[model samples]
Target: MADDTSGLSVPPKKLSHSELKEYAPGLQPRKMTAKYEKQKETLLRDRKSIQQLHKQRVHRGQSAATQKYESRMERKKIDREKKLYPRNREWKDADYFIDQYLKREAQMKTERVRARKIQNVEVKGNDEVMFVARVAADFECSPKVQKIFRELRLYKPYTAVFLRRSGENLKKLALVRRQIRVVKPIRQQVEDLIRTRGFAKVDKQRVALSSNQVIEERFGEHGFVCIEDLADTLMKGDEEKFNLVTHFMWPFKIDEAFNDQSNKVPGVGRSAADSGRHLQDKVEQFPFRFMDSLMEQACRRGKSRHWMGPELIKALPSKKEAKFLMKVKRKKVALKAKERKIQAKFDAIAETDRKVARKLRREHKQQREEKKAAALASKNKSWKVAMKKSAKAKEKKEAKRRGEDRRLIAMYGKKKSTAKKRPPKKQSKVE
Candidate 1:
């Protein structure tokens, strides 16, 4: 009974560490053997922290990549916007151009007045310049456009030139804007292009301007002794000096296929995924689009290079030429109307002749068909008569043959019933 009661009784309440120590007074609690478990817990916390840091690093990488991609797309969108030129704004009629010219003249007057008050300079038409490159990608251009290209020394695809703005040059560009690319090169770009691709005309032949002596020998009369002198004159934008220097130098040859920047010091010309974007950015101002043309881009102000002369304004808008063109256009319209009236008269006569011919063809076809029907009916009637005669002859011959048989049968005394006999049976084996 005692053992059963001890077994049945609940164990004395277990004390916590502090309670057991207080109850025991001087006795110490057992040291915990959970070092391995504590170590595992600590390891788990450290691993969790490491994983968190890794997640953050990965997230940062992903975010940076996303931002870079988005920025690139945005830049492409802006480039496309700058490059796009609507066709409706491209080719305006004489009336629209006349209005534009009048407005431009009025605006120029205001600009001149402003310049006089501010800078005390007597501003004239316009000081304009441009970089022209012949793409020759479009061959369907007019002969006039080709003539302009030849005059500008843009003889082949990728041929390039620096053209100072003038009324004459503007007219040429207007005639062949779609077949060319126009750029407004800055000082740095101009220097690079000249140093890398400059040429001199010697004895009516293209020679590279690699040395100052060659430049001095070719252009010494014009005081352009060195390559620097040539570049300086061009940068100055003087109409006369610019023209002489450009004609003196052969047209530049740019590579549309090789887009990578020419080799130079590592970081200078290199960029992330450069892929010739730096070079492409040089011409981003006047983008190559189907409807967009350099002639139109000359009007818009941009960040680096801008149009500042009346050459493009007057030429693209056809300032003085608009009136003359309008008169010629009226004459052309009158002539076209007269020609259309004459064509209408001829078409009416042709239509009448076609109707008469069609009626004659129908009558001829009907007469031939009628003759063929009569011939076929006569042929069919003759064939039917011949068939009838052949049937009668056959019946008479049958009757004669039957009479002859009857006579022979009578003479032969009934001819033993005259029936065909069956073949004899084979002899039996027993027989």
Candidate 2:
């Protein structure tokens, strides 16, 4: 120990090993306050106690490795549950499924051929898609056309429906061909709708086909796990699967009113397509244009693929449409401005006449009010006169009943002092 320099003999304090070591030029040991040291000690003690209690409660004595393994196995179970019924995610069973689909398609083809033979109608281009729109409103349509519209499920104008290019279906379509325009469906527009606007039935509820789960759950037996697979099935004319999917999906509501109305010739009965009335040249763009902005909004929300069906149905107009509307709106504003100017000019020219007309109107109103008051006063006087006449008649009748002079009382205006005091009715003295 080093000797003490003070007069009193005091022991020199020993420095800690950490403190004994020289740090870098400016670096020094952190100075700890008494409160800080106390807090650190208490925290360490509490942590130790918690760990001991946790260990005691977990009597299973499972180690970290075992717990980690159990958690991993639980995750694997969830992943397995999420997997398709086949247990294999890949389309390994696609060949057998395709064969099954082909067999059904062949059966449908045979049925259609038999139907065509009976109907004596030939349907060409089996792969072509027809886009049909109802040009007539339900209220104005004929009974026969109304029944056809009901069958097609299009009861309103701007309503669109799709038809397959098959013989029997084409025969049905031909019945309403005049009312609806049948055009070739655009592949891009169709694909976009299938991708964005498509829905699948889940638990009897219409759920959006955002994830592959609903498609897999419903169509997994047929080897379809996603939208692309479903589209391919429809393209290949897998009748059963196609019908099931179509029934599951809701009808596409298309608004073709966004097109130009100038082409609507007053007497012409032709379609807008023939008359060049469409706002967009590409017919396919109509549906996608109405639905594109909505899909973009959905995508922007950074939502997971599990969005519901109604959200996808909320279609908004596009920038081009907004511009068209703005142009139309400007014309409307100009017309309104012109009308307002005409109205103002008429008001200015007739200002003095209008003031004189107002004075005459006020005078007529006052006369009407005075006439009404006079009529009311006359009614009251007539009521009082009637009451007095009724009273006089009643009094005369009473006087006549008593054998008194009713005529004399009326002429004299006095009742003859209570009718001569009833002449002191003669009474014989009873013996």
Candidate 3:
């Protein structure tokens, strides 16, 4: 060990601990020390100086910079307030612009309305003149024509006839003829004939004239007889030549002329008046007895019935009565619709019930089958357990018997075996 230590370099002599402590007081250990006191004091003094400098800097910066920031914020707030308030100058300017625009728009609208009103007036005046012209062109004096002309103020005391010389003369003459046809005498004759003979019988009947009579009647040594000639011959002197037969035939001819004229234009009150006359004729020709029979039958059935008499004879309905009937009909229709809806609901309920019952039956059948299956499964499980138990018991019994047999054989195997064996002596007997 001395030799191994001799190969290593010698270390320097270690000084005594107390001599080292005297040389380096810093290395000396003491029971108590104030090592951090001076450093803590220096650090606290530095911190105090830094704090004072920071406070002076804050104080110096606060006045001008804070004032500048506050002034800027206040200016921004004032600008925002101006933007929001309507009393500001900008808002007033916007309002003035809007008001001016609205005034201009309203002025333009007024001008448009006035222009439209003037145009409508001109159009109405033109329409009236055209209406008058049309009526003059297709002048007739059938009951329908009379009614239209009367409605148009043709028969008024202030009315002035404006007859044209050319084609209008024929139209005026046609009107005159129609007027003459509506005479009371002609109407009475036609009514009497209608009452005496049915419409079908009258329609089937025809007027017949022999060939000589036709020749004599149509052309008696002169050219074809013109309507003007007949009119001149018949209305000579214009002493109000009136005949019952002519008056009766006149209405039909007048109606035909009116119808033809009406078909041409079909505007104004003329066509409407013609339609009214046609309606009147139909009403006059209608069988009242049939309506009476229907009413009587309805009355017998205990149902309320109304017989609408001749249209001309019926009282004009008041607005209130018409409104009331309309309301009543609406209510009746609503009630009928409600009843139908209720019937449909009942039918739906019945159908739903039938479906529900069918569904329930199907469910019940399925449930029964499931229950039966569950019972069968449970029975099978029980049978399996019983079979397992029986098999276990049988195995135990067999094991017990085999153990007993082994013990018996071990105790009396040779003697029991010899006694159970049988000798064979049949071979000696055969020798």
Candidate 4:
């Protein structure tokens, strides 16, 4: 019988330190050899059994769950199909449906007609000429506006009518006699016509059209008629005629006329003063007013004192002064040509320098990239070497630890076997 006051018994040890070293160098001190080995084997077998049982349970649960889910999903699919394909009549009345359908059709037809009308209107005035005509009508009505209409009629084959601003009152003019002539610049002509009629009198409304009217009318199809015929008719008597002639000849500048002494000509009398002043005025306003007349007279007299071009230049005086002026002009042109050549050379040198700088910058950038790659490669190689060394050290340490663990286990096994064979300890009674 066991004593009630006694403590639990410990297993006996068999192997000593030297004995363990001779028999099994792997064994540790103070361990039960046999019991430890037995316990280790039992623990390993239990672990494998538990793993197998857990795996079987998981597989059974997954199979049952999947079968249940599939059955539920099949029932739901059948119910959804039944709902989508109903056999009963959901709408029993046909009269209301037909009326709604017909109403929608009528609405669509009306919309289609409206869309077609809009498309037709867009196509009708798609040309640029029509577009310009519409834009011109937006501005105030003037002679210039009429002139634009005339030009549009002359150039475009399409017939366009201008509408007056008095609420859609459109006027369709006849294009049967439309003709365009490149008259001398009409602005200058208007200015001359106004100036020759006396600026003060013209400003005072002596002329039927003011300078602005004359300018605006020049652009008009019939405005030039008022300028040529109306203006000539309005100027009556000698004073008015003289003032008109002078104004026409000296439109902008009155100072360009020669002095009275310079106006003297061979066999010319006092009566010719008026004619001379008119001729002087025409000369002062040359190219602006009577360019064609000047060109013709210059051609006839063999004197190139005209405003035309080289033909007129040749007709100028063949004196020493004129020759000297031509030489000076030639010298200035030659100097300009030399300056342009020097500028070209400087531009070429600058372009070459820019290209060379760009090339050097590209090479420097490439060198930087190579250097960075070299550094990164060196770093990677060093890291790989360090990792290999660390792995080898870890393996060595693990082998040493495994050897120690085996020694401890073997010693424990031996001690356990010895303990099982030892005689039981005598116990005292505690009655």
Candidate 5:
């Protein structure tokens, strides 16, 4: 207790902990102001970070120890699978499912084949892969064949796909095999194909394999060391790697002009190989020409393998061509102008002739009218003379009988003169 100035007893004010801490070094309460909103923002930011942490923990939580070891292992495996490939977030879910389904089916097929081998049952599958080029589009075929085409990705004409010669594949292929030309491309042809028409799929876009460097960069270290290796592998590599090699390449699209080329050259190698294999007891082969056929085959083979230097490009007319055309058009225009000028000159001459003819016609008409008038005047003059003579004779006879002229009468019944029309008055001048 302490005494105040007025002599009344007073108690000393106690210092609160917060007030003491505020006065202490490096410890003070926050300043309050309406302008500052950083505190609330900081709180909100902390809340969001905490929520993220909680979600992470929940998503990555471990299995309980009380759970069975098998169940925990299964749960961990499911979590790993979900993390590795989230089904909900995938766009190609059906493709994944199909892949899994195919893998399972392949396993089953192997098991069945094993059982059949043990039981001495027959099995069918081909090891060789052939280059199948679609020459004709036959959507009008039955739905089964259309489905096969869809699977093979050979719906477009002049496009080719690599197809394994499995029994099932061949059976499906034979249904429409005539429309497709299947041939085993040689090493040279394979290299030529990759060199000329090789394209790679990058991010679902077709990128042209412009050089050997591009091919090496893309497919090195895995299977192919260089473009040559890839081409050779595609041609005569292990049959197992055939599908894998083909997957790197886009379907080959032969130009329309080269559509039937594979068809023609398919027998070139085979015919050459078996030409002398059997010379006798085959058929009555007379004068079998070889040079022409060989040359044609060689030409076709060259054209089929290599691409031309540059495609035909259409362009606007050049300055020289345009100038020549302009000169031609100018000549035509000048000829037309000269023709019009000649026509105009001829028209002027015709007009002058027409004017002269018209003037002569008018003069002749006037002369005819004048001649008629003169003849009528002469006849009228003669008639009038006869009439006057008769009238005078009669008048003389009457005069001889009467001998006195009648008295003249004065003008008394004449009409009065009418008023003349007045002339229009002119406008007065402005002041």
Candidate 6:
């Protein structure tokens, strides 16, 4: 029992450095082994530090060593690239521009998917089927808002595009609600949209309609025979058919809302969304719907189908009618020229008469001013003459009195003839 206790109590000895080195060759110490390991650690630390510093310097473009390495790598990469693509290996400004353009277009196509999507959208029973149209021409919207407009194909002011009343579409329209006008779908307007400003997809290209045959050819399988049928399909809320027709149709360009009214396109400069009257309210208050008014104007401007019929009261002008119109235009032009000539002559005579009247008035004023000045000068001259006459008379009377005094002195015989000397005629010069 005592020997078992001693054996069980004994602990294992730790391995010596020699034994560790013998088992693991890497653990063996050489000359300056500690110093070497220390130096290795220091070298590794310095290398890591250098690598970090090199990364920073490369980012700052301040590392010559990194620059050289990049240049070498670039040369190798260029060589590889040249081997890979030798046909159009030369890069130019135009190539760069084309690359940028393709990139931007691809990015735009991808970015269009980010608008809010509505799931399980439905057109329930008794729900009014309506479409929204953009009326404002503000293109300086936010990127997301502009992308929404671009997706809707409303590129300019008064360009109308039909929008379904789906939740997703409603959300998209709400983003640009201030700039757009929502209205009750007018059948006439929709027909006009398809007839005049409509484009159909022909061979995957947007081409204007030549006849109802184009629609029949493309949508005949879907039972759309003409423009009216297509418009009817859109109105019935058939999602698949509606999307196809809208996609085939180009954006409809219309005139401004009214002639005199300024285009109060919301989101242009100020927040028109918060303005006094909502755009929808204003649209509802209009005498005719915005699009209907536009359609009316278009109908008036376009010749009637009746006029295109067999009747000859107001048919489209033929060559003979065109010549007659030209002759009438020339005669009208001659009459206008004569009227302008007569008006010019009358204007010239009136202008000359006005000049004469102005000249007479100015001469009369000058004459009155000159006469007053001459009258004042004459009065002053008369006063000067009267004073000169008075002075001469007084001098003559003084001379006579002096002579009488001299005669009295002579008669009296006192103070002798200290008498008076008369002035010589030449010295006096009394003329």
lDDT of each: 0.65, 0.59, 0.42, 0.44, 0.58, 0.62
Residue 72, candidate 2: C-alpha displacement in angstroms: 60
Error of 1 at 256 (Å): 7.0
lDDT (10s digit) by residue, model 3, range 185-217: 223333332233211111334322212343245
The best candidate by lDDT is 1
- Cα lDDT tens digits for candidate 2, 111-164: 455334435533342554555665544433446557767776676665665556
* Residue pairs of candidate 3 with colliding backbone atoms: 141-175
Worst 10-residue stretch by lDDT in candidate 2?
304-313
Q: Which ten residues in a row have the lowest lDDT in candidate 5?
A: 307-316
In lDDT terms, how accurate is model 1?
Answer: 0.65
lDDT of 6 by residue, 213-316 (tens): 88888888988888889778778757777888888777654443333243454332333333213333454433235432112222244442222122221222
lDDT of 4 at 307: 21
lDDT-based ranking: 1, 6, 2, 5, 4, 3
Candidate 1 regions exceeding 4 Å error are: 1-125, 237-240, 256-292, 298-431
Q: Model 2: what TM-score?
A: 0.33
For model 4, the stretches where C-alpha displacement exceeds 4 angstroms are 1-237, 241-318, 414-431
User: Which sections of candidate 6 miss by over 4 Å?
Assistant: 1-128, 203-206, 256-288, 291-431
Instruction: Specify the poorest-scoring 10-residue window by lDDT in model 4.
Output: 124-133
* Tens-digit lDDT string for candidate 1 (89-200): 4565897769767865754564444323423322233455577766553243345556667898887655678887655565556556556666666766677677777777
Candidate 5, 97-162: lDDT as tens digits: 797677657645644443333234222544554677654444323454456677887766556776
RMSD to truth, every model: 22.3, 29.6, 38.5, 42.3, 31.4, 30.4
Candidate that scores best on TM-score: 1
Candidate 5: the clashing residue pairs are: none
